[model samples]
Every structure is written in C-alpha cells, then in structure tokens.
Target: MKRLLVTGSNGLLGQKITDLLVQGQFPNFEYIASSRGADRFDAKAYHYLDLDITHHAQVLKAIETYSPDIIINTAAMANVDACEREPAKSYEVNVAAVANLIKICEDRNIHLIHLSTDFVFDGEEGPYEEDDRPNPVNIYGEHKMAAENLLQQAACPWSIVRTILVYGVLRDLSRSNIVLWAKNALENGQPIRVVNDQWRMPTLAEDLAKACLVVAERNATGIYHISGKDMFSICEIVEAVIEHYRLDASFICKEASEALNQDAKRPKRTGFILDKAYEKLDYVPHSFGEGLKLIDEQLAKLQSS
Candidate 1:
C-alpha cells in the first residue's frame, strides 16, 4: 500500500485532504495526517502525528519514522499581514522548512507535492500559466516563491500546486474563511466593505485537495495551476454569498483595494488559467455559486451535530 503523509493536517487544505483519504473510498492508500497540535477532527479514524515543519530535526524525524511514498505539504505561514509583520517567522516556515523537506525527500526518493499561492505574481499580468515569471508584492509571496525555487534545485521529484483564495469548512475550528465571514457579517446585519478592484478564481479546499491527490496518483512532475475556473472580484463573491444565504445585501459597502489600507500589497488580477491542469490532470472545479452551496450543506451538518 502507498502511504501518503500530509503535513498541516489541522489546516483547511490538510483537513480536506484527510477527509477525502479517509472517507472518499479511494483504495490502496494508507494516510498519515500530521499537524503542529492535536487532531482537530472529531473522528479519530486515521493516524495523527504532531509535526512542526519549521524545526529540521522534527521534520527529519517524522519523515524517517513514517517514510511515506508521497508527502503533501500544505503547511504554510499564510497570513499575509502577519507574514509582513514577522518576516523571520515567515521565512522559517515557508522557505527554510521547505528546504529541509526537499533534502529529506531527495534522499528518501519520496515525491513531494507542495502547495503554493497565486500571490507570487505582481498582478501586472495575470490569469497566469505554469511558466509565468513570479514577481511577488509581499513577504508571504516572496517566501512562497523562494520555496518554489528550492524545489527547482532539488533532485527529488516534485510537483508545485499553485492555488488562489482557498475557502472551505472545518470541524471544531474557529477559523473563518471568506465564505463564512461574509455570511456571518451579512446575516447578522453587520456592515462589510468588500474590495472590487481585485480579482481571483477562489479555490474550494476540497477541489484543491483532490487536485493534490491527482498529482500524487499520477506522480505528475513540475507545476500546475489548480484553482477555480471562474474568475470574480471579492465584492462579487460576497454578493453571491449574500444571495446564497438570503442575507441582507444593503450592509455591504463596495470599495477599492486601496481603501482597505492592508499591510500586504494584493495582486490586482492574479487568477490562474487552468488549461494546463484541465489537460494534464483532467481536474475540474466547482463554480463560486456551487461552492457556496457545498459550504451551506457542510454548515447545516455541523449545526445539526
């Protein structure tokens, strides 16, 4: 049986990957889910290991112990503003840790599938292909780009899955995604200012997980843009959320990206063009509206439980 070790198992993408492996009925795969803390999932059906990817020793020990055929690294210091404020911590998690994993994976001949973001692009030219040159506007993107560079120099077989605006549900996790955040604010008659200047093809976390699995199953080498096919602005997405939940739309204040005064500089139109992923992995993604419905169903189940 092929063993797949997923890092950041407590995270949104990692949890989705775990859920699919345990519940999706795919055969011949034993999964090891590892995160920094305790298992976040209510069901204890899979092996859970505490792993901190930043520490080289801990990373090396975990890999040596599990010896997985493939390591899906979903762990990242993803908070844009926080990454700006603490560049050192960001570098440790995003760049140096990835280098450590690359070395280990190289020696062990384990295929590594690393998750990345669309923020690598500067937003001057977008709908990026796999080969697009990256010019990151923020510390987070720079670190991600650096990690990608590390993989390029490694002898180990690797696949980089670059995604954008990932959103999904999590069990027993207080983390809020764009979907939930919008729904909550609108439903409670709370006002929100959404940016209309930026554009993204928001990826559903489940779809991204499936894309990662597909990459592993095929042992696909090189980079792929695995994100939603539909492109829309943040305001449009919030408007869709309001429509889906039948929430009050009057409270939403549409604003430009400059008005937010965010610490990190956002790419203006950095959505991916998925022709390569479509042709290569035969991957398909949910529409923004479909994604909202899925989130609603998941939320209903969570509430009832």
Candidate 2:
C-alpha cells in the first residue's frame, strides 16, 4: 500500500481531507497528517506528526522517516496582510519550505501536490485558464508564485492546484472563514462593511480537499484551476450568504476597494476557468448556493454536538 502525507493538517482544507480519509475515501493509501504543533483533531484513524515545514532539517528528517509516496503541501503563510508585514517569515514558510519539499521529492521520486491561491493573478482578467500569465500584487502571492516556479522547473512529479476564497468550519474553531464570519456577524445583528469591487468564486473546503485527492489518485501534472463555477463580487458573496441563511441584510454597507486602505493590494477580478480540471481530473465544484447549504449543515452539526 502507498502512503500519503499532508502538511498543515490542522487547517480547514487539511481537516476536511482528514475527514474524508477517515470515512475510507482513500483506502489504498495510508494517511499521515503533520502540522506545526500538537494534533488538534479528535480522530485517531490516521497518524499525526508535529512538523514545521519551515525548518529544512526537520522537514528532511520527517520525509526520510515517513517515506510517503505522495505529499500534499497545504501549509502556507496564507494571510496577505500578515505576509506583507513579515516578509522573512512569509518566505521561510511559503517559499523555502516548498524548496525543501521539492528537493526531497526529487531524490525520493515522490509525487507532490501543492495548494496555491488565486492571488497570483493581478485581477485585470476574469476566468483565467491554466496557461495564463501570473502577475502577483502582494507578498503572499509572490511567495506562492515562486513556489510554483520551483515546481514547474523541478525534475520530480508535481501538481499545482490554485483555488479562490476557500471557506469552511473546523471543529476547534481555530480559524474563521468568509461564510462563517458573515453568518455570525449578521446573526449577532452587527453592521458590516463589505467590499463591492473584489470578485471571486468561493470554494468549499471539502470540494478542494476532494480535488487534492483526485489529483493524487491520478498523479495529475501541471496547473489545475479548481474553484466554484459562479462569479460574485465580494458584496454579492455576502448577500448570497445573507439570502441563504434567511438573515437581515439591512445592516450591510457596501464599500469599494480603494476606501478600505488594506495593507496588501488584492486582485480586483480574478476567478478561474477550470476547463482543464473538468476535462482531465474530472473535477466538478459545487455552486455557491450549494456550498452554502453544506456549510449550514456543518454548522448545525457543530451546534448540536
């Protein structure tokens, strides 16, 4: 049997992937989840290792020990503003760690599936295809782009899965997503300012997790644009959430991109075309409404438990 390892196993996508694996989603492979700290999950069906991908020696040691056939790298310094604030830390985690993984994969002949983001695009175009040029506007995107370049030029088997606006719930509530944030804010009757300019096809965490598995299963190569099919401005995204949960939208205040003096510049209109994924990987994503329905179900389960 083959062995599969995932970094950032405490994250939303990681947890979702773990959830599927526990349900026997990939019975042919053994699942090993590694994070920077102690395991946050309650499930014991898979092995968990405390791994900081930033440390080259540590990462090399772990890989040497685990001897995984495939590695899904979900670990990243994902916060745009945070990356902008701390360039050194961001590069260490996002770029250097990937270099380490690539080197190990090259030596071991391991297939690598790396998670990326839509922020690599400049937002000048909509529904980008696989071969579109990348012009990252911020530090986070720059680091991710660098990692992609390394993978593309590497000798080992590699796959890059780029997604947009991923959102979902974790049992520990360690992080918050757009859907959960909007629902909670509106539920509490708190007025919110949502940007009307930025646009994205938000991805469900579970859908992305499944996409990663499909890529590993097929050992798919090159870039695959994986995300929801629909397009919506940031404001429209919030409005849809409001509509889905039957919440009051009177407190929503629409704002433009410039007015929100954010630390990092975000792409104004960057969504993926996903034709290659549908054709090659046979990957299909849920609609924004359908994704919201799943989120509601998960939320209800969390509350009941």
User: Which candidate number has the best lDDT?
Assistant: 2
> Any runs in candidate 1 off by more than 4 Å, and if so which?
none
Q: How far in Å is the alpha carbon of 256 misplaced in model 2?
A: 0.7
Tens digits of lDDT, candidate 2, 1-305: 78999999999899898988989987887999999898887598888999999888988999999999999999998989999999999999999999999999999999999999899999999779978999999999999999999999999999999999998888888879888899899999999889999999899888899999989988898999999888999999999989888999998999998888889999999999988989998888888888888877877899999
Clashing pairs in 1: none
Name the lDDT of candidate 2: 0.91
TM-score of 1: 0.98
RMSD in angstroms between candidate 1 and the native structure over all alpha carbons: 1.1
Each candidate structure's TM-score, on Cα atoms with residue i matched to residue i, is: 0.98, 0.98
> Candidate 1: lDDT of 170?
89
How well does candidate 1 score on lDDT at residue 217?
A: 87
lDDT of each candidate versus the true structure: 0.90, 0.91
